[model samples]
Target: MAHTINDLVGTDIEQYLDQHEHKSMLRFITCGSVDDGKSTLIGRLLYDSKLVFSDHLSALEQDSKTVGTQGGALDFALLVDGLAAEREQGITIDVAYRFFSTERRKFIVADTPGHEQYTRNMVTGASTADAAVILIDARKGVLTQTRRHSYLVSLLGIRNIVVAVNKLDLVDYSPEVFDTIERDYREFAAGIGIEDFTCIPMSALRGDNITESSPSTPWYTGPSLIEHLETIEIADELSGRPFRLPVQWVNRPNLDFRGFAGQIAGGSVRPGDRIRILPSGLESTVDRIVTADGDLAEAVAGQSVTISLTDEVDVSRGDVLAAADEPPGSADQFECHLIWMSDQPMLAGRPYLIKLGTRTATATAATPKYKINVNTLEHTATRTLALNEIGVCNLNLDRQIPFDPYTASRDMGGFILIDRFTNATVAAGMLHFALRRADNVHWQAVEVNKRARARTKAQHPAVLWFTGLSGAGKSTIANLVEKRLHEQGFHTYLLDGDNVRHGLNKDLGFTDSDRVENIRRIAEVTRLMADAGLIVLASFISPFRAERQLARELLDDGEFIEIHVDAPLSVAESRDPKGLYAKARRGDLVHFTGIDSPYEPPESPELRLDTGGAESAATLADRVVEHLRTLGLLTPPPAG
Candidate 1:
């Protein structure tokens, strides 16, 4: 039988083990915007190092013949461009990973996409890379894409940078062209605080200064691309950083064994080392280090290892393990630098899911302090963030989360925002610092109950939850009821969906999880209002029955009046007061309640009004007011 590709890869791994004993591996990524010749550069490096197998070489030769390029000679770009679409389009759309080895070093290269549209994919590749090869065409020196890639590399905390100035052949192998680019890039790097940068001139197509010195450029005397990569000192890049290991999974094999398994995000860990679990702040000593092969005395950054603690502390997934002396602080609020990726702009007070390392939590964008101008690096005071824009914003987590400053540690500080409903990543954020400090003064509040406040106000304060489909006249009817109550000298306040949204609920959206948190926050606000001796009239779509029930739980029995504003879907569609139903019907909107989403109607309600009839808003308001009066919430008429 013949060995398959998987089997061949396994065999290669075994051969690699036999050939290289006690040798460490270095993983790096090639990153740049599209048309930067990243793939060609990587292909040239692999070919010059003689790492191409016979089968791969034969395939490349066959592909070159089919493409009709010069007598079946190797088109090096074909070596890494495995995707059919990539081959046809001549652009990388996803991260293509390749592994090869030379006698001096073993390497894993992540060839990241270059297009600005694929910035998320680039970040994904650079997140795990120790060094970055930023390709720049000698013809176009220091383009916008070049600056963007450089900023990303620094943001990701990739310490070592190899600026491979490709296509020297096109520049007539002139040292001046390379020197001008090098100087221009150095100025940008210095401004961004990137101190270590190595510039090398090379022609990836002609194999000039890739593995061998190019005779074309005698003035340039830097080491070849391959030589620089083989000897670059990356061991000290993450060596001095503080230890941080985010527990991704809890490993318990049997009754006697228990351990936490995750990749070492930064620094090193050894047996008998004391570590603290953040948020819980529990201290424990490392008992043993375990891997797939066997036990080990210690593990360094980038290694995947399971660690057992001696104290038997309650540590779980989403918890971070760090050095005891320099532990991460638990904070509920953070100020972060964010790069928005969604077309829908970021609205204030909208709740979203924040994922950091392996931990996920509900968070809200508290305020948009400023949006940074990417071109000038200037801060612009803005209220909202649009797609592909960078901004500095404050985030309030639902619960306390421990994190490090991005300047201090990338692994612990970087986070991504995921749309809770679509599960699409919408933003990449870097934590600057926690806005709220733990050592701040704490104040205790005086005791006050909701029922006593309602009695003192001389009225039965209740939340009038209006539930219905869009265009069901819920907000209009709630407004009328508030007017009638005010005329009758009853203390009442109306919380309309649009009105509250402009201020209190400004940050919310129509996403499912956002909807959930929206109702949760509105319910909390309504609960506070009812406790403050006022009847709160909340006019919202309040689509889900479960969420409405959650709101009801925050109040006493009979204090939450579920007002079902009943109207047929067809009638609501025809009304289309906001023209939103038409848009939803045309599939222009996603997650629109009553169109795509299931709007659970209220089973029972204190007041049910059929807005489809000839009844006016005044008549409905009168009916609700009469009911409140009968409940003794309103004073009787003096001379009726």
Candidate 2:
């Protein structure tokens, strides 16, 4: 009594259905141990979904017969891993992305590598994924890689975890083995603060319980992986946070129009919303929102728009436009989590460009205070960090920037550091919170800042730090430079080690710890003087490189110029201006540098004057002035 389509009324049902169906998309990743069938699983998903073309299927069948690991069965992994090298190695090396759609929802899956060395690639795959399909071999219940990936997914802010217990056919479809792994992983996930995870059983090779529930497992009662993926909802939390948009460009088409253009990183915005500018603290109201098609009434997170302001304020690139009533905290120091990705290790106080949102600033990271143990979840103290290491540390920037915590806004809170010389991306970081001191000690808003003061003085504020052995002519050269600057009508201040020890550092001793604190105080003082728009010259032995670097990090970009008075140790000892060197030769002083203690010379200094050679104090002072002129620090005053 049932009629076929030909006998019935329909002429083109396929075209009718295609015009009306609406499907949402979900992006997920497959990650597990090596040889755990991650790539194979993706290949199976493609073949079973009818996404593989007939021509590709013919090649796959022949390749499978010749060299496949499945005993003449089709090698499904070839569908995802297309590279010849990857196929020969029988492993997934890079992140293989595949796209397909079902009747209900479209899917984009990333098949990530399972080796330890490629763990960073896994992070790349999971960084933007909505769900993670972590494969686990039933024979090996739980592993270090499983835990490691789970921890990484949590760190990347992914909320969904689908544990696929693969290769169930290898265990004879035993419900007992499946239950044990499910229970063991549940406990582990709970311990690591991951509770929103699901577990399913399947064999990626035999096509059991992948798209359809396997008849062999009569005891299990859960939806297949595809069904679960199609139904679960991905809730976007960034859209609910406070409104913020980092200005990427200033659009000025003609005399009558100007606008700030950028993607909305957090919350929502519309006409009539009042906004505040960060670092400058200017206020304005949104007058209009323009899009490519037409004017929009409002736009939420992830939408790019050009916005006009009611007031003509000083807005520019690298500035964040935020809600006036709920502006983010602004500071130069923050404690954050960082993942090192470079071959060169992260060295303390080395300048790197940190790009957060649309803002970029010169930053220096302290040596990692502690590192997280990937397997045991223990925090261990460390002095050095290398590739694939995740650590917590403090970073100091050249100027204040605005941001929220990573938990509040992923788009605005994440940042990456780029190497200055190579321009390669070296690290990825997420802001946790601004140091409590950033809030406790707010920048005192004054009528004048360094730029205004510098204009009045006709020169920029800077610090010339001098370091060498005890009698390296550092003080002599610094004194001559200051005199030459004075003749040039420049204001300056000098902080000599002996003079500072007489008063400011009287309580400090020559021990290593005391020396560190002494330099710290001197750096703070130098920063204060620079803020007052006066050039500062600091002459110190500064036997340790770390302490000198600490001093450099306290100043603004291009504000600290290091001059190494490169006199040989013998030359310094022979021309000893201070009697301390002679006393140290008689064993009267214990920590006299170049005699009893070591002097770590600067690897690369801005100026290396050879007092041991023919360079005179006056000539060296002239060179210093010339370098300053080249840096634009000694330029003419700005015109009114």
Candidate 3:
């Protein structure tokens, strides 16, 4: 194993410790199709490196006899697959990290799952990896998942790749077989922009060509996997990029000492260096680079240190300290590449919490520009991203944040999208660049604001949002409510679903993505009308709760009233006011609520009307008007 001193007890302990401490570290991941022997390969590495303890090795042997897949031989995979479920199924389910070292270098290998369903877990393991080991069964050649993993490795910027064609003994070590697989893999890898890679033929279970060259493959001429890993040059590119330190905390043990604490994400920083705070553009000089040991003259990327600023600037947890000369850009909107990981599809216009570096912001995504078919490498058009899907989309954040392109610095550009309701991580994304419009567009101030317009009209602006299924009497009741408001000398506007589709949302369909966009458009319009001091009545079958919540967030407190026109599917279908239900049942309509699609009813609406009851549409309208009157919305402005 790369000239390692295995006799730990015999050698001078001080000398060994010094040698080990000086070795550089490399992080890598193993991934491929299921049963490609990823765990076995890692277990072999640990075993050959003499890292496993004798007691642990004894347990592995006993377990191998009971549960091994190699005909009662020492199943090395048992060393890595520690979980009971993984052992029982003989598969890798989660990312298992293992540390082993040789005389040349220290290594941390991640044994990632190869199943298509656990692709997200694989991505997590590869995100920080410097290289990737893609195993392929000699019998199967190149499968779809092989291409998928390779593409992901390329996408994650793992330039160092080694295609380990395991199970070479299964093919009788034929030179022709090895040549064919190597040719096919090289062709596929070139298509995905993998310019250079090393291919090694080996059998992990038999321990051939692992730590040493195997005599079985006489025609094969290449170093073993461990030799390549130790010799590969994985340059420290982050130190050359622009300096960035996302303040994780404001370190203040006492009033006399105050410094910002965080790991330097990119480049180096020193005392007296000019720095700028992001999203604020405030400038200052670094006062001291403090660490646990003491103040330092300099610190580079990946080092955790606290630094005090020369000026008393307003810096907090989410602020980024950057080099004044080459600072990153800030933007509220961006185009990014997203890897959807959750079971629920990613819908356009629905807000999700985005965690980038040390900052968190509310983000809404537009429909995907395209989704990549990993197997074929084609960009196919799609409205939404499903589980394990990769797509390019535009995201609008609630506020500006500093970032670099992912290619420049991963820590400054990578982000994760979390579900606001469940707090589950739903997607991982990379910032390509901020959209130009995000910088160019600025909100123009007006002298006459919403409060002045409302006072002039002598009424409070409100949005009476009526939501329900089609043929549920929502439109009819909303029309009656607007007529009553007009009769009462109030300025009102009605935005009906069908009428808006004919003009405003003419190109939109009834798909989930389109529905989110539909509600987004209507919410913006509703906000504009309310700003004009007009009572806006918006009627639509807005199906998703997320979109409904978006509309609520756009308005001021108590300004948007959600009125659920409750009606059973059976009752609404029986009414059939527009014969839409019959068309849906006959398969003439697709994505129809209560038919092929789903409709998420509001959980706690401001008002609920039982449209299926004996109450007529006019009675429901009067109930709405009375509810508004009780809430003080109907009261005229007090005299000045």
| Clashes per model (N, Cα, C within 3 A) | 5, 0, 0
Indicate the worst ten consecutive residues by lDDT in candidate 3. 1-10
Error of 2 at 102 (Å): 0.6
Score every model by TM-score: 0.76, 0.76, 0.94
Task: Give a tens-digit lDDT track for model 2, residues 1-640.
Answer: 0111231227677664563245577999999888789989988988888888899999899988876778889989888877887888898889989997666677889999988778878888887799999999999988998888887788877888899999999999999999999998888788778877888999989888888888988898898888889888978776888899999999999999999999999889989999999979999999999998999999999899999999999988989999999998888999999988787677665668999989999887876789888777888998556887889999988789988888787767888898865688888889998887766876578988887887888888999999888888889889999999998899999999989999999998885556656777798899999988899999998887766776787788899999998889888888877688889989999877888777888889888888789878789888988999999998755654
lDDT of each: 0.81, 0.85, 0.92
Indicate the worst ten consecutive residues by lDDT in candidate 2.
1-10
Which candidate's lDDT is highest?
3
Which number leads on TM-score? 3
Error of 3 at 426 (Å): 2.9
lDDT of 1 by residue, 137-173 (tens): 9999888777877887887788889998988899899
* Candidate 2 lDDT: 0.85
